[model samples]
Target chain A: MDNLVFERTKGLTKKEFSYCPGCTHGIIHRLVAEVLEELNVLDTAVGVASVGCSVINYEYFDCDMQQAAHGRAPAVATGIKRVNPENTVFTYQGDGDLAAIGTAEIIHAAHRNENISVMFVNNAIFGMTGGQMAPTTLPGQKTTTSQNGRDPYVVGMPIRMSEVLGQIPGAYYVERVSVHNPKHIIKAKKAIKKAFQNQIDGKGFSLVEFISTCPINWRMTPNDSLKWVEDSMIPYYPLGVVKDGDKND
Target chain B: MAKVLMKGNEAMALAAIKGGVDAFFGYPITPQNEIPEYLSRELPKLGKVFVQAESEVAAINMVYGAGGAGARVLTSSSSPGIALKQEGITYMAGSQIPGVIINVMRGGPGLGGIQPSQADYYQVTRGGGNGDYNCIVLAPENVQEAFDLVKESFDLADYYRNPVMIAADGLIGQMMAPVDIDKETPKLDLPEKDWATTGMKNRRTKENKDVDPNIIVSLSLVDTVLEEMNLVLQKKYTHMRENQQRYELINIEDAEIVIVAYGTSSRICRSAMEILKEEGIKVGMIRPITLWPFPEKAFAEIPESVKGLLTVEMSMGQMIDDVKISNNGKLPVGFYGRCGGVIPEPEEIVNAVKDFLGGLNG
Candidate 1:
């Protein structure tokens, strides 16, 4: 008899994603779903969706979901975690939502050591709003809002969020991972799993920042977006753990 | 329930505990700071959750999360702070999440003052946030009613599956009054919050079939779906308007002038009525308990002997618009108010009514 070697994770709904053809959000969503299914927390998990490309993610995640206003996901998640202390809570946010409008919410949640997991997706450009300049946009990278190639003299450099968040005493774990290739994708899943695990074990404020691809927004093909993430984004973002409270690694 | 003298803010804190609130998230602001201060000490003792959020914006979003999770949550702030909370309150309204928001209003056009004021009449009644929505706004004129209305707001919020607001002012929040914390504030018969994001652990069927998970969201990308959602919201508001209109009327049978006011301003109007009565002028008052469901019907009950209706407020004539609409041109509605943080004196209101009456007769 042939064994069913693989099947879709129950954490995901049957709906197809609305992401662009080559975006990494689908892959990241799959990984998060797989992690929740594997951890046996699918039924007990609650995901907070942010206002960006993934605002409609509530339709995809099988667990209970909430949609928050732009950049307010962290504060929303804090409310959920505090009220449902036994249930797992996580927020899925992007660069524009987290680094720009939601900076205070994220920093304060980390400062309070709120017991929640945050999946920070950094594509270095605003994807949903047609390639606007993001706080994490590289200094010389071009965007619709920053047409003159992101003037470093005026706009300043890309913000190193992982390092900044790692310095907060409440942030028990912080990491930056990339999904440009299979090898890095595996590493990224490991980091994401650890963040969820930390929350499950009652640890506070674990976040995994995924260096992702925005092919359409980047004005590149799917394959080229992966290559760009590897060649350019990784060099600036540095793929590794910035802080680990467990220090297991 | 033994009666005890308590400040409005402390009474609200005690009422929240008695009201079965599961959690509170708030930021410190003048006029309503006692809410958090009292909750921080009291909620922990009752084993309820309390978090003094870093900002009013965070506090309201926290309310969104807890309320979405099917918990009875609350938050309090003053004028400027409530303005910061508008974004989150709009989300709660859109998502149909149940929560209580206490806005102990102070003066404001920008950080106006911490003194008592009803200047937020436009902000509270007209939907301060960006959206087509109406929160069930309850205005309590005194400290005791502040406690009672706050307790009532939680149940009403859950019953309607919508946000309920207690729009008091600095005076009611700061002044001391007798209250019975153990008073039995009746609970509404609300449907089970099956949509609440409380873990779906028991939702699995005996045959191992999974129910579609609940989602508390407001974003509807499809035009048809969003329009339908808005229609659903409008229907809820219509129901609220029909059933939730409340007001207090006194001596309207033989009055020459009817004074329409609410909250702290109503108290001043009451004082003015007494002064007018002693002067042989028949004056009465209509104090609305629910501001958004603005007691429009009260105008129909106005006696024909009444020459005009006067709106007394602590702002520069914001509620006059509602007063005029409610009167429907049946009577000439005149507005008497003090701007900034100034409270109108009883004598001034009495004199305004005399002048209005004098102009009508002559």
Candidate 2:
């Protein structure tokens, strides 16, 4: 009857997303869900939701979930993966939750080469806290915290987590991808799939960093936010595979 | 099983194994390092998980994850490390996850010392973590009691779906004594942990056929929802208070003075009672085993002949507040303490009891 060309992924629950208008989090969530479903790991997947805009992601993923304290999702994921080795475990974290307060946790998780996946969303601002400056917030970008535009001398430069984690010997696969347009959206899904597949194949500590947009906090229209991500964010955080364990082997 | 001489930290480690711990996560801290060392060597042999986390903060969060995943998890640290873990501890409590934590106390306002101290009485009995939550704290007076309580803590944690703590002092962690590792602990009729996040593949309910994914979370953005959750937690705490009060009375019958103490201080009080008895003075003790529940019923058992109460501790009288509250001003209360890793002798406690009684008489 109907063409059946498109439908919702089974990895997602019936709960509707509550992201602000023009936020790319909904799109990223769809890509992750699609990848989990395509890989047939939805039922066995355990997602650790961190503090931030995505803290309530437990309601969106149709899989077992745990809500971790601020900046502790990596540690939580490590625990889940270590005990339930056969289960697929991953953490969903925003920049402030991963790069700032949880730096030690994420670094140590990588150092241990824990067999888990990580989905890091970088919108360059603390979306849930009403546009505070994030560790990933670009220098010269204005936010509630950096009213005079970011001064690298005053605070610090934006941290590129994918590149930082890629250098770690324990990290098996690391990549940075963006979701600004349809073409890049397809590429982002590919990287996300590989990250999950690496874990399915027993690879250690895979991570996919998504360059997402926060239109509400960016003080720009949804379309302008996408343009900003391409024009501003991409020049600083280039997209592509940062490391591949298979190639090293 | 036959008794074997075991160091306190090692004995507790073995007891945790015997208690059916599924995983151990911990960090290196003074006075409690032996615990993680023992588990790091032993757990792998038993095909159980053991992780030396980056810090006490990570270790406790790991405990939260494993416990949420339906594994019986344990972690251990000393005073300063335990302070670092308060955040994760509160999260576990709020999530109603089951975990066992061992706090082998050392002295501290900050980095106090490596020696024995009961200074953590307030931190353990009162909530060290945020929120309206209380961990079931067990204070053991000796190595054997420490072993037994540690083994039972897992069961208690699971039965209540709450965190449990073994509030041992440094003496309990470093001292050596004989312990029957196979000693039987009372079994609890625990409910099945169907809420654990073990996956959603086979989980099903008869009515729904397809079960919803189990979510382990403590975040309730709605104020009303959080208040309701707090009420539920309060009910659980009240039930714990009703059923879990434990204490031991020694020579309390027909005694003219009673002593309140727990852990290493209680052991000293026992020797003090014997010394007072030898001097023809009747002295007794109410040794509290459950610090949070605080054994108020034991106060009711105080002999009418008792003139006053003396609470002895290794710190500057942290447990005196509980003793006063339990005594309810029926008898005058006095405190005797030696702080900064100092241990009081039996003769000192004997003198303190006499002085307390003299004040009451005057």
DockQ of each: 0.86, 0.88
For model 1, residues A174-246, the per-residue Cα lDDT tens digits are 9999877889889989988999999999988999999999988888999999888878998999979899988
Per-residue CA lDDT of candidate 1, range B1-362, in tens? Answer: 68999999899888887788999999999999999999999888888899988899999999999999999999999989989999998889999999999999998889889998888888888867987988999999988888888988889999988999899998998899889777777678889888999777856778867577889998887999989999999999999988889899988888988988999999988888888889899998888999988878777899889889988889989889988998888888888899777888999999999898888887
Clash number by candidate, in order: 0, 0
Q: List the residue pairs that clash in candidate 2.
A: none
How well is each residue in B81-178 modelled by candidate 2, as lDDT tens digits? 88899999899999999999999999987999999998888787776788889999999999999999999999999999999999999999999999
Task: Give the 10-residue window scoring lowest on summed lDDT in candidate 2 chain A.
Answer: A1-10
Q: Which candidate is the best by lDDT?
A: 2
Looking at model 1, the pairs that clash are none
| Candidate 2 lDDT score relative to the true structure | 0.92
**What is the docking quality class of candidate 1?**
high
Q: Mind sharing the TM-score for model 1?
A: 0.98
Docking class of 2: high
